[model samples]
Target: MQNAVLAKVPYGEEGCAEQHDSDLTAVIIDDCRPDLSLQRFALQANGRFKEIVEFNSPVRALEAFATKSLAADLILVDFRMPWMTGPEFILAYERLAASYKPTPHIVLLSAMPGAELKAYEINSRLLLAVCPKPVSLDTIETIVGKIQPDQ
Candidate 1:
């Protein structure tokens, strides 16, 4: 029953209506790793959304969000960025999207072990998942679980 209820939540690619940009539109925000490479990895992750945008800088990411259209189905933000931390980025993103009628899905990806604590300190519910470093194909599969509908 709980799973059924969770299926209706819009925390991921599942359970949500068809977005305007439904071709796996995603944003990869990572400073340490190569965005293009990570984007390709995400594409092969077998998720509902696709990787479309990649940003190595969190500040540029915020600018992209402000200047460009909010068409991304998911955002994979890395932790421990130079300009802004992952949590900070999320906070800023949330504030930026507050004006929007509905917020989009965001996934925080980090290699640091302490990233979890930061995520919990902020809005635990804002992030759909926290993917650790050394991401693998199998790990991606494991993380890309069944999408549940928004309750």
Candidate 2:
């Protein structure tokens, strides 16, 4: 999976200059494979992606980050997991990502209502938005395409 991710992107190294048109790298962390697949499809349909990496476990994803085996322009995280909740992952990422010159933007995905999800006490400049689960093409285009109004 790692090899595939690295190979699929046009640019090989981080901060490479081959970026254009569709150069965004996104990391998706979700325990549900179906959700991951659907989200991946939606993101691909958005046409702004260079690479997309998926992790089923926060522990493993953190390990990848610690080892510098991962780099991303955006990260989409599910709010509930057996190992670590979305807020916990965001906090851990905050601690681990201090050295990153341009840390990845994050979007939290939850089954909860938007209002309820927004109430999560996540303090990070990296957080862009909290989106509802079962990602769709509209969700990808509207929320992700702009990636603005950073929260």
Candidate 3:
């Protein structure tokens, strides 16, 4: 599974770009088979973002949930994952909200368009938007800009 997933993204050692220092931070959680190149491209094109934290595993992301609440201003979550789906993460996030010092904005993304409707039916408040993968940087930038105060 790991091999197949890595093949899909083909991770390379790109030198870390200088980190942007701003109050707003974004967290991106996706299944292993994401188009990371597209994600990076979108991020680069936006140019308004500060910091971004990415996780391939929902479990690992959950482990660092506390840290997210401390620093993140917004979170972008994929709808489908191996062990935990995006909506499930929101359920867990709701429970964890009691302990979160500051609540971060949450948005949902999916390759499937229907998932957005499902997410909306589940709870409109939990999800800010549902976007398809390979989404353009302009679209992502617009969405992020709306959510982040610093953007």
Candidate 4:
């Protein structure tokens, strides 16, 4: 149950150029601590997200969303969890976002072979993309690239 925020600092010449690029906020919800850590590490390594928040419980993530404290440019959720499944979380998240102006991009991560495609079919606009479990850096980069900065 480790909840933490990882703020990436811009560094080096390349980092300096992208310092003012975009302030992308990302939220990650995964029941497995190790998996969450791995996702966070990959995102940090990519250096695209300005702020990354991690939650080990989907329920807690929903609670934060209810309180309007879980706003993000992109959201990464695990497919299966104790309190809610990925689809259930997406449903709740869409309901919450309906009242807001701009909706955040949602990405589902699962070990299921066709989970990503199924999720896209469920909610094409709300869901940006899906990545396989044990997420690879390339997969993450592809997803991140698809997300446009919040305007």
Candidate 5:
């Protein structure tokens, strides 16, 4: 599964230049495979993110961060997962080596009502917003607009 998924995206040592720019490396972590695919498609269609990396496992996503293979300017994380919750992932993400610099803008996604507000209150500094499930293009655009372009 890992090999197949990795092949779909340019996450190798020699990353794909066409897939990324200096502005934003967006990572989406969700346990639902279909949801992951949907998010990736939406982001690609919107054409804002320099790169879009999808992980069905929050644990693997963290591993990517631990190895410095993943450097994100924007992160969209599902609030509930088997391995770890969204808040827990955020905590672990904060401890990653890539996090030492300016922290990435994180948006938590959940089906629970008012989850976004709660997530923002928990760590407004890192979390940009909380979005409901079935994330929309408008929501993605709104969040992307908040991020300053690379100088």
Candidate 6:
């Protein structure tokens, strides 16, 4: 369910989606529904992305990647998900052909502490960052700041 408080809040101009200037496609993968809704809202409010796609499972998200359906510019995935961890997903994603990989930034969101999180650090090429659970608007800004213009 979308947060009632956030529903009342307005974004940049009129509210909600306003055809973000960046025109970037952002994909969010999370097993939790409420968290997914909030993440979508945060990205919408940032006004940097054109489209936001949600996946409840990393496995389903991987399927999208394999089928060339998801051409994401920014990806936000939960680290601890059933079937595939975010790092594992990144590793599998890296196996796709060069033409299949369009995403420039991939963020892993986790509630796991530093030590445990370090164990999953595998790819620096595709995985751009690691963020905390319940991603806030500030976190969204920081992630967007990392995205370069050329990308």
What is the model-wide C-alpha lDDT for candidate 4?
0.75
TM-score of each: 0.66, 0.80, 0.71, 0.81, 0.79, 0.82
Per-residue CA lDDT of model 3 for 25-117, tens digit only, reads: 566777643455566456645554455667776666676774553345677777778878888888887776554544577777777767445
Taking all chains together, the TM-score of candidate 3 against the true structure is 0.71
List the global CA lDDT of all models: 0.58, 0.75, 0.61, 0.75, 0.72, 0.74
Query: Which numbered prediction scores highest in TM-score against the true structure?
Result: 6
- Indicate the TM-score of model 2: 0.80
Q: Rank the candidates by TM-score, best first.
A: 6, 4, 2, 5, 3, 1
Q: Which stretches of candidate 5 lie over 4 Å from their true place?
A: 2-22, 97-99, 115-121
> Which sections of candidate 6 miss by over 4 Å?
1-14, 17-19, 100-102
Lowest lDDT 10-mer window, candidate 4? 8-17
Instruction: Encode model 1's per-residue lDDT on 1-151: one tens digit a residue.
Output: 1101111112244333333333545566777546436544544445445434667777877876776554455667777778888889998887776654334566776666764456466574457777676556565555445333231
Q: lDDT: which is higher, 2 or 5?
A: 2
**Model 5 TM-score, all chains together:** 0.79
Clashes of each: 12, 0, 0, 0, 0, 0
Query: For model 2, how does the per-residue alpha-carbon lDDT over 1-151 read when each residue is reduced to its tens digit?
Result: 4312222333344433333475577888888878987777777666677787888887778888888878777888999987899889999998989888456888888998878776778888778888888987888777665653222
How good is model 1 by TM-score?
A: 0.66
Q: What shift in Å separates residue 140 of candidate 4 from its native position after superposition?
A: 1.2
Clashing pairs in 2: none
